[model samples]
Target: MELVFVPTPGMGHLLSAVEVSKLIIQRDRRISILILIIKVPMTSSILDSFVESQSRDNPYPTRLTFITLPPLSNCPDPSSFSFFQTLITLQKPLVKQAVTDRISKVGSPALAGFILDMFCTNIMEVADEFMVPSYIFFTSGASLLNFIFLFQKLEDDEGVDTVTKFNDPEIEFDVPGFVNQVNGKVVPVVFLEKEGGSSMIIDHARRFKKSNGIIVNTFTELESVGVEALFDQVSKNIIPAVYPVGPILELESKTRGGSQDESQDKILQWLDDQPSSSVVFLCFGSMGCFDADQVKEIANGLEKSGHRFLWSLRKPPPEGKVGMPTEHETFVDVLPDGFLERTAERGKMIGWAPQVSILSHQAVGGFVSHCGWNSTLESIWFGVPMATWPLYAEQQLNAFELVKELGLAVEIRMDYRRDWKTKKANFTVTAEEIENGVKKLMSLDEETKKKVREMSEKGKKALEEGGSSHMWLGRFIEDVFTNVASN
Candidate 1:
């Protein structure tokens, strides 16, 4: 049996898809996997390097095939195109052609089905034409999935304008499958008020229902309520068969690699010099960075907190771009004058740091993150508490879910939004707020630490034999074969 996986172009999405694909391959050596790479703007090199490394490490490299699609012609400005729009509108035809060509091959492997990222739902039409099953591989937690279904439910039942009118100082409203009222603020901003945003979400939900099932990158123990809620919603024909087959994380060995680069080694050595559980690891996601002013404020806050820190500082993006390559030389110039000199003894700032290795280190106790789901999982996997600083996309929602719903993170700024188009700043987190958030996360009470540790253990156990996540994955594979045979 062979499965084709299509993941959107973001690092987090690609990483999740890679981990899940590896899991699928490990389960059955006979089953081959093909990854159809969609070429998008921004950085292709990062995705290229990661894919190359994964292929090198796999024992059955021949079984894993990665095909990169030709770049889109006359591509729209990335700043104007929402990532979803770019994938669904621009690349759908190319994806269809690629899959069609692969299936038409004379001696090709039997194409069992397609596993698509939630954002890649547009490919389902091709799946139908080929008469193969399609499944969704959501990269985020179950809670967020549940919220997305609820968003569509509200739109269908109460009209689109009902959801579009949501504003700050969030009003609580009941959502099906959830025990408590979900705040409007906790919903992804795309669903709130952006033009075509709600429509895109609703369309994805509609297409998701057409898929065979969904595989989320979270474990039942970590999100049992949300998992149950998802199933309930599915039972009501809100979506599809839901499978919780994860906490599928990239292994530490892969992250550490065979040899470290010079900078990585230096960062590790600096971490070695710190006391156990004393340093905070601060990194926003790959796309996360702050302007010069925000950088200076963060420095002040870190200084005021008086904690040992490792900061991964990236240069701000170009005028219109959401994220850009970090220039190491500019980091010092952008920072406050003498800030580095004053904190030189206790703080280490680098252009980029090995996040997974640093999180796993004994010296790290807390994470100051952008609250991307991948980062959230990594922090939880390492049993490090968080100081949530959400930047864009569904991060704000993830931050709220972590701090308020899950009680796992300290909030730095929950309601913050930076306009991507106009580059107008909606809000800036002050040094004091950053300081308080760091102090709160680092000084977590015994109860909170114990709770996080327990969750961490539960995540580990879920991957073991007979565990919920393990069993769900097994069932998913069996179902795929069963469906194929029946068809």
Candidate 2:
């Protein structure tokens, strides 16, 4: 049997989905995966290279396949909700036709199900048309999933003015996955808005229930409270079966070929020269970038902190747009003059990073990150403590879980968002603020460090034969087969 995987076109989502597909095929030889690659604008910088590498490395290419769908001609050019909404709509008929061709071929493998990235839930319609079971592979933690379900319940079932209530700091939500009641303020700013990302998320959350299950990229041991909360009396009715089969991280670097390899060698060499546990590594997710003013503050912060560091600084998109940060030929334009020379011995700033490898390095002690779920899991996997500086998506919420709910990470600023139109932060994080966060992170207390180490060990064990995630993966496969047979 084979399963079709539909992942949102973002590099983070696509890579994680690809990793999970490899894991599933490793566990059960009965299954092969066909990843349906949807085209999104401006992702070729990394996406194309990663896909090429996967094709090159897969020993059994037939069992692990990738099918790129034809790009839509008039899909909005931006990488916003509207672009994705239109792309999915126009691509639906193509997706259906692809499925038709696949299962229709003579003596081909059985089409058991589809595993969709969270944002790609609207494509479940194609799964329904094929009479196949589909699962939503939530790339975030179980806590965020709980909140999404709770938000959907309030807006659709109970006639509450959800956005206004979410905005009110006094109105804390009772999310089953959280130990403490939380105001929606800490979540992605989009959730509080009436349209744009908020509408996309709510619409996706509603489609969530129509799927057979949710395969979250988290392990039960790492998120015990949040994973268990879904089965609580109140949530059971609203939530579908959840499989916490993860910490599905890429142990190997998905190197973008060409200069990427040379860059990695230099990065690893620099880390090797540093003293053990002495360097702080700062890398935001693929889309995370800051304006010139914010960039100066960070440079100032790093210089004042008096610690060895590795920073990945990207060129922010032009004002009045939201998009990926491009590589800067030199830091001279953004940095304070003589700043690079002054800090040359103690710090190194590059354009791209090999995060998993860096986290695993002996010289790396702490991560000052954007708190993307994939990055969070990688930090935990390597036992590196983090200081959260959230940029976009449900990152602020992840920051909250790490710092307050689980005590796994320190906070730079729990609530920070960049205004897309102006391409500047809603409010700047002064050099002093950045310095303080770095100090707290570098000199982090032993208690939090111990928790992170323990969790890291748990994350490792979860993919072992008898571990929680392993068992959950097995259960998910069985359920897919059962559901498909019944269908």
Model 2 per-residue lDDT tens digits across residues 373-467: 99999999999999999987788899989998999988899888865445657689989999988999999889888999999999889999999
Off by over 4 Å in 2: 77-81, 169-171, 233-235, 328-331, 420-422
- Candidate 1 displacement at residue 140 in angstroms: 0.9
| Top-TM-score candidate index | 2
Model 1 worst lDDT window (10 residues) = 251-260
Best by lDDT: 2
lDDT of 1 by residue, 40-138 (tens): 666676777777776777766877778888887767666654655765567777878887788789878888999989888888877787899999998
Worst ten-residue run, lDDT, model 2? 323-332
On the 0 to 100 scale, the lDDT of residue 290 in model 2 is 81
Please provide TM-scores, in order, for all candidate models, with all chains considered together.
0.94, 0.96
